[model samples]
Target: AQSVTQPDIHITVSEGASLELRCNYSYGATPYLFWYVQSPGQGLQLLLKYFSGDTLVQGIKGFEAEFKRSQSSFNLRKPSVHWSDAAEYFCAFFTGGGNKLTFGTGTQLKVEL
Candidate 1:
């Protein structure tokens, strides 16, 4: 079965520091990858997505992810961490022509002052 994997359960970073959230996936056919963020009490919002064309896709809020087919990974990166960025980040993907996005456990990001 196709699935998304986020190895890190939680991550912490000081304000102004760079951040990276790891994501890996397994799929039978072409995969549509996505990154979403959920604030404390808000709904999940799409950060970025990679379907085709470029290997690296840019997202909102100064975020970007690179699709590495050889490694089956789509890691999210932010140049600098901010307190407002603190949220639960989910890595998701749709495989084998599915409408629903299969999401990983999620990686909680904590930012310090």
Candidate 2:
């Protein structure tokens, strides 16, 4: 089975500042990784994904993530965060058998002025 762990339960960053959210996964082989963001009262939105190819993957909202097989990590990064970027971020792994996803506990991002 595959699982995801987000060390930081909550994070705070100033507007226009850089941000990084850590995510670690456990799996036997290379697994499908994904980053999703959910605003208050909104559904989960796909931020980025990594299945193969490049180690660095870019997603919407100026977000990017690097898949490091050695570290078993796929951390999300943003050069400059916007106020609207404040939301709950989730790291997930696709099982690929039944279209199921195992998600992390989530990290709540608070944007300060």
Candidate 3:
């Protein structure tokens, strides 16, 4: 079965710090990977995606992720976190042979002052 699991339900970080969100997936084939950021009660926005080529991909808001095939993981990272970065992050994979995407539960990022 192809699925995704985000172990962390929520994470807290101080303003101007670093952040990382874990993402693990199980898929039979190498699928299209994506990271989305959603604010409180807001729709999802595409942060970045990894289809082929480089393993490390950069995204908006100074975010990046590295695709690891061995571990079946694609982790999101940010060098310096900001107050505006406080939002929910989700890892999604294109599966079921099409445009449909399966998303993880979600990891709420809270930025403290």
Highest-lDDT candidate? 2
TM-score of each: 0.96, 0.96, 0.97
Candidate 2 clashes between residue pairs 3 or more apart in a chain or in different chains: none
Off by over 4 Å in 2: 96-98
RMSD of 2: 1.1
Q: Which ten residues in a row are the worst by lDDT in model 3? A: 92-101
Collision count for each candidate, in order: 0, 0, 0
TM-score of 1: 0.96
Query: For model 3, how does the per-residue alpha-carbon lDDT over 55-112 read when each residue is reduced to its tens digit?
Result: 9999998999999999999999998899999889999999988669999999999999
TM-score: the better of candidates 1 and 3: 3
**Colliding residue pairs in candidate 1:** none
Cα lDDT tens digits, model 1, 1-113, are: 68899999999999999999999999977699999999998999999999998989999999999999999999999999889999999999986466688999999999999
List model 2 lDDT by residue over 21-44, tens digit each.
999999888889999999999999
What lDDT does candidate 3 reach at residue 11? 98
Question: What's the candidate order when arranged by decreasing TM-score?
Answer: 3, 1, 2
Instruction: Tell me the deviation in Å of residue 34 in model 3.
Output: 0.4
> Is candidate 2 or 3 superior in TM-score?
3
